[model samples]
Target: MNSSESNENVKEASSIEAIEDEDPTVLESSTSETEVDAANTSSSATEGKVRKINTETFIAEIFDYKANPTKWVYKGSKPAIIDFYATWCGPCKRVAPIMDELAEKYKGQVNFYKIDTDQEKELSGSVFGIRSIPSILYIPLDGQPMMSTGLSAKDEYINQIEVNLLKK
Candidate 1:
């Protein structure tokens, strides 16, 4: 083989090796974090099913709050859960799967949404005053939002949805 062709092959081989040599700790940390969040979120709704909301069409289906600067209006009708999270946050990763499960389980009853702090910083932070990751805000149709931090058990989430959201 010519010198140039041999060098290209060598470069490709090294790149693959570098990727394979990544630290296991980094991978474990991320995986465990996700697992933890999922465990916490799923704890509450073990029996209840949840529904997932599409970010792009959420406004059209639910309410047109996108044009409003406040981004929230308590209509006193449908209860909603807004999850503020970041991709790199360990706790956020842990809670994500649980959120998905809850969304599927609670499909038409309670609205579930995930807002990425890194991507929607201004919209999420400025409007919601989100100071930490894994912050869950439960908004009832008529009253103020009840905010909770950290990982909550599955039962708590289910109760919150049934009592606070579904009842109304």
Candidate 2:
């Protein structure tokens, strides 16, 4: 890749690494950090299902990224997986069923959520600095949240959950 592309990758890397720093969650999808619209949010996302989470729900359940940009503390009783995807993305479509299966498999053990890059622009682009689709934010019950981009096998997700989240 060119230098500019490489630099952009570095920025994205830094954004993801910020999660490791303080485990923050600010999905600056499109607009600037201060431009996010904080609509009414609820944390009523059902478990064991691939639920689509809006920006508000994201702030409520996962992290109040708008309010706390510098530090992110997960507000969930269970481990979580936030899948960043788009309706038009082919690879995202391919990964959806796998996520669904994994969600059902984990059920009460892990919470699975999908963030639409097209719908939540500020979240996908700005908060997370996601330049591509199928980026996953794996949040453990404690410690730092791990980021995995691109598509992978179902076993990989299982491994991530078993090793990363559950420490199994």
Candidate 3:
């Protein structure tokens, strides 16, 4: 690749590193309500609140990585934002509220799910290569899922959903 492209790649990677001291509290953001109900009282795909998902649910709901080891086949009605986080992570804790707000805003339009990295060893390190605490997976209905490591602005996440998942 050319220097400019290489530099861009580096910058993107740098921004998505495993944030060790990122203060999610330092950032500001807003919320909404409509299209999808991500996580609610139940882990229904229709809508609700941000909910936690495990390896079994992931395989059954998201992608059967073990079934199709060579390919990425997502099984969901709408786009999803999978927050792979740990309870001990400060940044993860900060991100929790944002995910919840987004879950309500994008209700019925998107699915917001969280995975505990500490609990799901196979899913985190083996399946998703989660080198960081807050490695988020943005999965579109008809496209390959993308991973963004580390902490970032809530607006950035919104942009990713709009551009990559919502195709807006």
Candidate 4:
């Protein structure tokens, strides 16, 4: 084989080696909401706060779902809200502060998460079917998660949280 072909082969091998060397436990712990929840529950930490979640964390903490194509199963102990947004989107920027306020108001009651759509394209597109910016997913303890796109009023978000998550 030529030198260029040999170099390509070495690059491929290095990539595979990198993947193999990653620690599964560390990866799981960081992304697993269950683990985080357990730790939080045992400690005296505050709740109802907002956090950033990636694809792994979404699967581990939020939904704990599998590759099943037909069923939706939520694995969280409390209700959750996931904001799907992009950095450059105006609507997303407008909704961010409102979400933060809501998180503070509902602290220790609900969980808030943000996913950058640009960074997590597969999760935004295939998993959540997100087609627009500032899409919010409101998940209750015992029902299907609802999705809302575009910018919404803070009152509207409050109403949804109360009705859907708080049930008050």
Q: Where is model 4 poorest over a 10-residue stretch in terms of lDDT?
A: 9-18
lDDT of 2 at 2: 36
Worst 10 residues of 3 by lDDT: 7-16
- For model 2, give the 10-residue run with minimal summed lDDT: 6-15
Estimated TM-score for each candidate: 0.56, 0.74, 0.74, 0.71
lDDT per residue (tens digit) for residues 57-158 in model 1: 345443445564434544434567877676687777788788778878876666676666555544444445555567666777765555656666666666
lDDT per residue as tens, model 4, 76-152: 78788888777667778899899989888988788888887766666776666565667778888886666766677
lDDT of each: 0.52, 0.69, 0.67, 0.63
Candidate 4: clashing pairs of residues: 33-61, 47-108, 48-108
Give the runs in model 3 whose Cα sits over 4 Å from its true position.
Answer: 1-46
Please rank every candidate by lDDT, starting with the best. 2, 3, 4, 1
The model with the greater lDDT, 1 or 4, is 4
**lDDT for model 4, on a 0 to 1 scale?**
0.63
For candidate 1, what is the TM-score?
Answer: 0.56
